[model samples]
Target: MRVNKWGVGVILAASVLLTGCAGGSDKPADEKPSGAAQEENAAPESDCPELKDGATIDGAALSECVTEAMADSAGFAAKMTTLGMESTSRYNPAEAAVATDTTFGSVVVIGEDAWVKSATGEWQAADTASTDPTVVALSTAAKAVDASDPMGVAGTLSGEYTVTGTGTRLGQDVFLLTGVTEEGGTSVDMVFELTSDYVVLAATGSTELEGQKIESVQEITEWDVEQDIIAPL
Candidate 1:
């Protein structure tokens, strides 16, 4: 099986933003948001839920937690690393930082248009007329990490999972969950880290791909804050 490195990044990045798909009406170059309009369009503060430490989580409860987090969150910034390549993304409802890395360079999406960053760091138009698979994947995965959402961090699992422990991460309290899946006699171990408010902070897992071992991690460092994810052009 041929593995598209970019697709792997997209799958991990999707963990952060799994609520909606990306696509919108095209905006003329002249219609891009400016000073005041940009400020006016900024995301609002998230009303994160109040969850105590040592709380238990199952698949259904996990889904509800993710729903609440995504609904309250304005947007988020995420880093996903797989096999040694890393892609960082920032997303709000209106704009997305897109997939960016040293290997595949970068792509930015705003409304219905997408742009690719050149080797010289110049931005150029990408095919957004129909639907570019990469762009669509980037779009749907650009929302915010909702741990309970199947489209989010738990996309790889098949059976049930349980929250096993609580601990501190970067001075913040977090809940830990683990799940195991078997495929072709290989066992994949998945672990998740969630905040006291039920927001997913990170997820790490290991599995074999085409007889090669691959480990992946996805982390959400910032959310519900003002992020300047503007069009590169």
Candidate 2:
């Protein structure tokens, strides 16, 4: 893992934000995004917030720790799942990639440019800068890092965060955090899985819209690991 990482984001952050930037399709997809190797630093465990079982910490402190760790990431890959939609993303400092498979189809974007998988499973160049509102919306997903989050991420959901206690995720010890995040004037209940050194392992949230409960999950599978991401010509 690289050095210092993470910072809070609007809502659902980057993983959820980028989950479906690509429309859905059934065609075969290209290779996963690639990234170049760059070594970074990671916050030592001792420097992180102390987690005690059944203890509580201020939400703002938890949020700050997560925010810092996310920004310090050297490379990472993650998935976001919601309403039967699943997306995979990979990021390193040099590049990033996001792919979503859903009814709209599959898509890949690097910076402001995009590529769509044709019905025949071929990659077609997409103009993210087009005047079309739909196209513009797709490009709006653009991030400073190769049209994506600098971390192969979208970003993270941030709010007044409170650490409920300590726990484990996928076998790694972690701090469990709870908070409510809002965007567009809508609020959702969110739970975060954070590592000892402040690495974000996953975050999940839910909200009611039109009397229907909607939920989203962000799972960080890799942190500060090696990654390879490349853009299609």
Candidate 3:
């Protein structure tokens, strides 16, 4: 199948930003803003913010933690469910397909989640592992890692601005990131957020698709991260 180059490009860009530029620099020539560095050099997380000991993550390590957490499909699934992406599991392929069609902008999950297809093509699971990489990666990419000590991710990561905004879902502090990027010859808007502990709480990416900028938002509540106590993402 032909690739939605713009779709993949935007997703990749979001991933790099959320990973705190940890993946290193290497952009395909097809990428835009020629000569623009793909990686942003951020100071070690030790410079970000701080939370109480054993209750928080170091800023530098926070990025790594989020990268790992976002890679966990179960965690992301939980968040997606909160965002109303339920029934798209390995058990119910049909519901998953319908759900994806209603929400996702560029792609959606179909089948028992054993397989996923977007405008680009199909993605078969490499193993029976329940974790969904796409969900985790997208969720993680939306969060903003702290810049100081205990660099937990908490907030959004947008192109023009990133910050810890207000709002709470499932009882976790919500942050916001917003900005714009050009795609398919049009300017698109993006917004995503992280929990206080650095988990992606929710995210929404909107672009002109089907003649309108469709918005999809995911809210992850029911956090069990802190011994069942109320804590930040």
Candidate 4:
């Protein structure tokens, strides 16, 4: 697919939210607790499968948990941030909305249509033909959200990772998993945060493209919440 600027930005944002920088630390340096206190305050160990340092995750179990959570939820919303891009997206399966702010300008997608807000503050239709990469990516992302298949994106990297019980996110205790992928002399690091229920709350990662380095972070919430998505007028 021809990756447009907007498409690349969205993909970068979504990927960062779904998976994080591979080798980054998840432990909060300032919040170290004693072993006794950690054990006392931690959720039951059974909540998460035991993961040895530097091992692959249990993909089947992880997928099962994510699928179950998605099946139980009504809808969800997500926010993504990168060096020069920020986006907020919401999905209810049948419909979705995404608003992105980039150094170039603002782009918004509502359902099948995409729009751009110019410097003069006029909203106009983006060139979102069926063959357009941005349109295809946005559509696929919405469908994935509707399917509640978080693993469809991150589950592909299910092996050889170190896991640690780490800091809180969105007020939920999480397990931080990190991994790396090397190709064409470039190494990308990714990190993922999973909640007690196996739900993925956030992901961040860094990679290089066209000789430029890109880093991104993403957060998702409102699982099973009632969300009504509408087209922008």
Candidate 5:
């Protein structure tokens, strides 16, 4: 896997948009909010490989779904593959320090630095660097549709997501992204965090590969951007 400088730059830049406040001091005991209730019902299970909130999604499984979706989608697969290769090459086992409700946690090796929020409000050095934007776009778009590839312009860039479970990357709480697709498939899953009010924090990837598979898993543990959250401009 080789890194594409141009693509990485674009994604890294876009990542700057993700910025928010992190907890510094501990909340007073009386003021601390209660944690969310544990889901009592079992997520709906199925062969469609949708990621439900609170469950783990296998990387290989995600790749298969992506590949299948991209079968006839022109060069989508190629782009994703390139990103996958790039990501694997640069996926160093490093820790990312970021804010949490209690203490700060790290997201390790979050897919080659797609961008992260640091103490300041700008993109900073992450465990890994980002892949090309084209690749990032294709993969993310595909995942949104619960489809394998970006065959048509029928995908969403943003939507509501619930945290079904959590995973640790360098001991940080990376939320497990899961929810049933309103159309087909079960719920799609990804490891993510809330970068800002609108952005979903994550590393770059070929998350949706050919043959409907997940080719890579990028774990993130920190953000190093350089702008202040109160005034990120």
Candidate 6:
């Protein structure tokens, strides 16, 4: 299967997100956290996807579920831990806007208007006039992807998935969904921890190549929390 540009961008950012590892989470399936846990330390989502041990949901359905959650949520917040460095992102569905704080700096985008800040520099609009490579690339990516894309990256994936089992994590009921597809010599795989109601708690992806391997993971540390995202410029 051929992954589109949108999909590739996800791989790169997520890969960059967890540069320290080639493996997914170490938490065992049996002891994993809630599939729909909200706030890393706060309560879990009141509305979540829960399924029986033998129940199942397809990839299309999974994608639709996540997409709905993204479009419907009033606001969304998540903390991504990569290589011991953390970045927290807040998304506003009403305005199709997002604000992210990374170890290196900060990024904010509202519609086609984007801004970037360096760890020690002031926020600058990442407009067409920008010459900085990173700013240029970020601007391109922001305009290319559908605003809904960032909220649920797994929803952007192409393939199928079904419930593997069920359990309790972070005091919330959880389900496991998995799928894998291959084209030619390349194989792609995805794993998602979901609330039976369809909220994503975590997602992981990996693929293999001759003599080389790559993997990326983004575990949701918080979800649907308060946010005050706005243009920095």
Model 5, residue 59: displacement in angstroms? 22
Q: What would the per-residue lDDT of candidate 1 be over residues 38-156, giving only the tens digit for each residue?
A: 22222223442334444444554354555455335556556666655555655564342343433344556555555664333455666434255544443333332222231254333
For candidate 2, the TM-score is: 0.64
Q: What lDDT would candidate 5 get against the real structure?
A: 0.26
Which of the numbered candidates is closest to the native, going by highest TM-score? 6
lDDT of 6 by residue, 77-132 (tens): 65554334455667776787877666555668777777876555677876545776
- Scored by lDDT, the top model is 6
Tens digit per residue, CA lDDT, model 3, 111-170: 222223222334433232327554344323222111121111222221343453556554
Per-candidate local distance difference test: 0.49, 0.51, 0.32, 0.48, 0.26, 0.54
Candidate 5 residue lDDT tens string, 1-233: 12221122122212321122123222221221222211121222324244445444544344333223222211111011122222211111122111111111112123222223333233333323246443343223212221222111112112343556644332223455542221122233323432111122232222322345332222222222121112111
Model 2: residues with Cα > 4 Å off, grouped in runs:
1-41, 44-49, 53-64, 94-137, 143-159
lDDT of 2 by residue, 92-175 (tens): 544544443333334565545566553334455654566554334333433223322333222334444567877655446777
lDDT of 3: 0.32
Candidate closer to the true structure by TM-score (higher is better), 3 or 5? 3
| lDDT tens digits by residue: candidate 4, 4-97 | 1222222434432222212222333234333222331223334445544444676544544554544344555555566645555554543445
Give the Cα error of residue 195 in candidate 1, in Å: 1.5
When summed lDDT is taken over every stretch of 10 residues in candidate 4, the lowest stretch is 1-10
Candidate 5 off by > 4 Å: 1-84, 88-160, 180-189, 194-212, 225-233
By TM-score rank, best first, the candidates go 6, 2, 1, 4, 3, 5
